[model samples]
Target: MSMQITLRRARPSDAEAFERMMNRPEVHAGLMQLPYTTADFWRARLAEPGGPAVAELHLVAEVGGEMAGSAGEDPVGPAVRRRHAMMLGISVAPEWQRRGVGSALMAALCEYADRWLGVLRLELTVYVDNAPAIALYRKYGFEHEGTHRAYALRDGVYVDAHAMARLHPNPPRPSPG
Candidate 1:
């Protein structure tokens, strides 16, 4: 039997499950997350205000009524010139890794960025050792631009990361006079 996956905007009510998923040993190992993330932290983050101007999107994936994964996009910075660019982050439960959960989350994020938000650039960094994640991102059109040496510390050792990005495949065209 196949699992049914659903995607929706994350809510404060999902704080507990979100925290659990992010803190899982296998899950946090691949992400930049530190151990012991609290439910309160996720609650506050999920409840943060957003609007048309904010352009922030956080989505959770559910399967069999359980949190399977989450993905999001945040503006690269506060500068007006950077409005067209957003950074992406995603995480899937260890059991859900090989499933389509990650793909579903990526599809929704890309759709929102390209169609509704008028975003032209989506970017992310992944540790070079994470081949599965790198393949997934490439499947979604992310191209590696460069590498960052000692980008972050994980397990008391510095790790390198690949800077990947995807530009809008079909940017809007201005009306002809």
Candidate 2:
């Protein structure tokens, strides 16, 4: 039997599940997140208002009413100059990896960025040793820009990362006035 995967805007009610996924050893190892984050932190963040001004998006993936994964994109900064770009992050449950959850989340994010937000650039960084994640980003058209040596500290040791980005394949043109 195959399970149907669904994607939707993340809700405050998902805080507990989000917290659990983020704290898992297999999950957080590849991510930049620090373990032991509280549910309240997720709830408060998810409860915040988001729209064009904020240019922030958080999406949750569900299979049979259970959380499978989550992904999000946020403007690199608050400055108007950076509005055309956003940084992306994603995490999938251990059991759901390689089961199309990541692809579904990436498709939704790309659709929103390219079509709705008019975003010109999307960026992400993955640890060098994470081959699966690197492959996923590459499949989404993210090209490696450079290597950031000693980029982050995970489990008490620094690790190198590859900075990757994807530009809007078909940017819309402004009408001549």
Candidate 3:
């Protein structure tokens, strides 16, 4: 059976749901974030507008009127030299996994990056063992960049991560003076 899900920009009011989603053991296990994430953290995150240049975008996935997942994009740095490059993060509920929730989020994000933001490079780091996520990223054109040993601490033990990225075919063109 297929489930319908909607994607929209995240708002401050979604802090609670975002918190709950991140607190799931399965979700946290795959991420570098520690357990016991607070709603206030998400609240503060959503409360701020991404700056004049839209250096970041946070999107929420809704399923049957419930917040099912989320995806975020931010720059690798604040300097002008790195403005065209960005980093990505995504998370989905256990129940929503393998059910198109991730695909929707990725699609929305890639569309925004390509059409709206004109980002030249989108990067992400995923656990090396996360086959599902790796495959999903590959489906969207991200290729393996490299591996980082002890890239993050999950559940109190160091783990390796694979760096992946998708370089936009048409990078943003410079404005003529």
Candidate 4:
């Protein structure tokens, strides 16, 4: 039998469950101290600087009505210069890893970018040791832009991350008849 999964935009109310999903050991190990992030951290990230918050679009994959996985696109900035790009993050629940949930969320995000955001490209950074994630990014057409050596200190040790980007394929223009 197959797992029943559904994808939808994430909301502030889903905060607690999302935090729980992030606590799995494989997730904590692979992501490097991720489970250490407090629930308040996620709350702040999902919101803005004021008492209210900045609005951002994030997606979650729900399996059997539980928060199973998540993916999000964080716009670089409102500066006209930076509007063309957005950063991405993805996490699949431990039980759902290697299943179709991650791929489905990725596909849906790409579609949203193409149809709604007029996005010229999508980008992300993946740590060098996370082979599965690197494979997934490559499979979805993201190319390695470069490696930021010693980019982050994970568990007191530095870890490098590879920057990647996927540009929207341009459609051919019509020739003068």
TM-scores, in order shown?
0.96, 0.95, 0.93, 0.85
Tell me the tens digit of each residue's lDDT in model 2 across 67-141.
999999998997878888999999999999999999999999999999899999999999999998899999989
lDDT order, best first, reads: 2, 1, 3, 4
**What's the lDDT of the predicted structure labeled candidate 2?**
0.94
Candidate 3: tens digits of C-alpha lDDT, residues 1-177: 677899988998998998898998999999877788799998997998667476588999998999998998988887889888889999989999999999999998898899888898999999999999999999999999999999998887889999999999777787899
Candidates' RMSD to native: 1.2, 1.4, 2.1, 3.8
What is the overall TM-score of model 1 with all chains considered together?
Answer: 0.96
lDDT of each: 0.93, 0.94, 0.90, 0.78
Pick out the ten consecutive residues of candidate 4 with the lowest summed lDDT: 47-56
* TM-score of structure candidate 2: 0.95
CA deviation > 4 Å runs, candidate 3: 172-177
lDDT of predicted model 3: 0.90
Task: Encode model 1's per-residue lDDT on 5-98: one tens digit a residue.
Answer: 9999999999999888998889988988898999999999899887767889999999999999999999999998988899999999989987
TM-score-based ranking: 1, 2, 3, 4
Off by over 4 Å in 2: 175-177
